[model samples]
Target chain A: MEISKGWNARKKKQLQVIIAFTIVPLFLLILFTYYPFLEMIRYSFYNMKYIGPRKFVGWRNYVQVFTRPDIIRTLLLSLYYMVGSVVQVALALYLATIFCFKVKGENLWKGFIFFPYLINGIAIGFIFKFFYTRGFVLDTVLQVIGFDLENLPYWLKDQKINNWSLVFTSIWRYMGSNMVLFLGAMMSVDDTLYEAASLDGANKWQTFRHIILPSIKTIVTLNIILSITGSLSAFEPPYVITSGANGTGTFFVVMNDIAHTSQKVGLASAMAVFLLFVIIVAKFVQDALFKYIFRNADTDDESADVARARKKAQKAAARKAKGGA
Target chain B: MAKTTAAKVRHHYSAGTIIWEIIKYASVILCSFIAILPIVSCVITAAKTPEEYQTTNVMTPPANWLNFSNYLEAFKTANMGTAFRNSLIILVFVLLGSIIIGTQLAYVLNRFKFPGNALIRNMFTFAALLPGIAMQVVVYEIMTNLHLVNTMYGYIIMMCGTDVMSIYIYIQYFENLPVSLDESAFMDGASYFRIFYSILLPLLKPAIVTNLILKGVGVYNEYYCANLYLQDKRALCTVATSLYTFTGPLGSQYNMICAGVIMSLLPALIVFIALQNQIYSGVAAGAVKG
Candidate 1:
């Protein structure tokens, strides 16, 4: 009877602890994340604002998202940022490989490069604004290199150079963190692979291609996909530095303006939903591509094994056909 | 690995290899210089007088590098004292709230075989993938209806609510810790709460540091929600928003703006210099495990 009573007490204690710990966090996630997401979907289907009654506007907001020329143009701007992300990742990979081998004052170089990632996004906006201003930092640096002021293009004014300038800032801010990530992955590669490759008289390029690439393939793919999504939501540099001026308005900037300035909450939500769709599609395509390319590398249960077996059967059939012919 | 690489280096010390080494060093230095050049110019510009600022080139050194009046004026005009104070309050509360919620949730999820375990884990992963900025439409409405706009605690609560990363870090940390410790404690007469508070929490120091660095920097630099929720600029301006006072319609007062920017960057720079290794390792570990 006493043991039964003790068991009951322990069970009650377990129940209380579990409930107390889980309740608040779950509530917060639902309120902030899940519920808002659901409401965003609902709001996109209605003509509404922060104040006033909602009216059902079936598919109108979504239709406007694709039909509006300005919105379509803003979506195209994501391409520029996407290109920048690719270059940034490549540069990060190069630098990570170099740092992994050997270098003097490696920590100092890493610190200098990575320091910008720690700076507040707003501060970077201000710094770049000053840097790009005519007769400012960029012009000064160019002048020191013997370039004439008459021949210099304006950094942030001309539409041609303005977007490129913004893209460079993104690279500067993000390249360091990406480098550190790649470095971590590279270091985690088995050292014996390098030893064996060296014993076989492999060159630097050969070693990198055969061993390093395969080892860090997962992280490389993950970063590429993340950069695509990140580019889709590009807001900070344009929002803070130029306020989306000079044909630099990205998709997110357009959404922010529509929602906040124009008070077109439904339309803005529709734009957001469209961007989310773009990201999801991009991620899906990337996964499918990775699976196709790295067929045996994937750990999926049935599909991957089936793919391998199918490939083997096809090869056998090809051999039989050759022999018969 | 080192010996093999060294042996290869000795054997391959040809003219081509030497040229490649020089190119590598040069490119790394150029990259580093590009990364830091603008901030260096900001420092130079911040020290110049108004007369000198207009007359001299941007990279020109000021006569007095020690002149600190611009920083003082920026602090006074932007009312950065109040901003810093408010930011401190928010930081303390948000950090405490996140650590408590994150650790307890991770502990429960890690220790117990609950019914909704897989569901909750999947929920968090899915939520992280969802573009958080996309949900601002309805979140603004929720905050308004709850009368949370323009209040400190409201902003704090909102900041604490979106902290999925810290919970992820803690969960990752908890998985590595042996479950036998908790099982043994339960076998003893100790209660679940006692076991968590006395035994498990202490072992999580490294995770706490990692979370603190990540979350602290994020909250410190966060301006979007802070700008929206803390609408009363006079009372609740954060370090980020405080810098915007110089960037209004009357044109940017960049002399003062540079000073304020430097001020805002100082704390982070100091902490980074002191804890560079910890920050580097923590960032690396977080990325890998995550």
Candidate 2:
């Protein structure tokens, strides 16, 4: 009877501990994330300000989000970023592949490139602002390379090239981190595979395609999805450097303007909700596309084939060397 | 005959391999140069006097490399001392809160087989899918309701509140920890709280470090929420927003602005250089798990 009572007490104590540990985090999650998300959806249907009467205006704000020319233009600006993300991924992959091999001062190179990712975003903005200023760093560098100062366009002032410039900045800031991620994934690829590839007389590109690519496919897919969605919501470069001037206002920047500057809380909420919907759709599409692409590339089957191929290649190479001898 | 064959094989691949190596080094060097070029420009400009800045090409070396005027001016004018103080306060509190909340929640979720455990896990997983930036509009409203707008404690709480990643990390870490540790402690007549605090928490050092580095960098550099919620710029300016002070009335002073940028970059640069390995591995591990 005493032992039963002790067991009951312990169970109660465990329950109390669980509640104590979980309650605050759960409350925070609900309050800050889930509750706000639901509120955002509700707010999307009403015409309101921060501190004023809210009237139910069914789907009007969302209609404006779709139809408004300025907002539409901002959405289109994502195309630049989408292109940039593709380039970013390619560059990062290339660097990662190269660095995975024996290289002198590998850590130094990685540190130099990855340092930008560690810098404060606002500081990067200010640095680039000075960089792209007329007759400043970029133009001066060009002049040293035999181009005239007069030939250089105002990098921030010119609408045509400014977005590209901003995209380049995004690429610069992000590419290294992506490279580091790819490198980390690549480093985990079995060492024997690379040795076998070399023994089979496979060159660098062939080895990369057959060995490294297959091994790191998951990370690659992840990086792509992240970059694409990130492009759709690109904010910092335009927000900080140009203040969304010269046709660089991204979707988030526009929504920020609406919510804060114009005090159109309802409209802004609608835009936010619309973006969230688009992101979800994008994520689903990417997942489906990846599934389609990788349908036949199951790990078990691939590894089996690779093992068999490696054995065959090793036997052939040994036979060829024996014949030559 | 075997020696000749081996030599021939080496000769066959050496030329191509050499060229490939050259290309690889060239690309790495070029990329490293490009990455540092802008910051290098900022550093160069930060050293120049106002007159020197206007006269000299940006790539030119400043007449006086030791010019401290711009640094002093930017620091004073931007009120960066206060900004750093606020940012440090925010970082300390947010990291502490996040670590505590994240670890405790992770412990509960991992060690217990309770009724709502799976539901709670699913809730967090689903929350991760929700685009956080998109929900800021309503989050702003909620903050206003809570009177958290423009207050440091409010910002700290809000920052701590959104730390889903840290919780995930802790949970992943906790999975590797043997539950036998808890069982053994319980067998020693240690209470549940005692087991958690004394035994399990000490074992969570790695997860704690990873969370600290990742969350520390994020909270330190977060600009959007800091700007929106901390509307009283003078009182609530962080290192991220303090630099924006240069963007307004002092916008044209590139030298001064560059100095401010360099100053802002310094602490992070120092930390990264010191903890490059930790930061890299932590980020890689976190990204893979997340």
**Full-model lDDT for every candidate:** 0.83, 0.85
Please state every model's RMSD to the true fold in angstroms: 5.5, 3.9
Model 2 residue B5 lDDT?
A: 24
lDDT of 1 by residue, B64-112 (tens): 9988888898898888999889988999999999888889988888888
Leading candidate by lDDT: 2
lDDT of 1: 0.83
Positional deviation of residue A177's Cα in model 2 after best superposition, in angstroms: 0.6
Kindly list the per-residue Cα lDDT of model 2 for residues A1-325, writing each as its tens digit.
Answer: 9999988898898899999998998898999898988888888999999787999999999999999998999989999999999999999999998887777798899999998988788988888888898888888888888999887889988998999999999999989988888888887766766666566665676668666787688888877887888888898899888989878999988888888889898898898888878878987898798789778774424565675576566557655765797
- How many clashes does the backbone of model 2 have? 0
Model 1: residues >4 Å from true position, as ranges?
Answer: A1-11, A191-201, A298-325, B1-12
Model 1 reaches an interface RMSD of: 2.0
- Which one is best on DockQ? 1
Docking category of candidate 2? medium
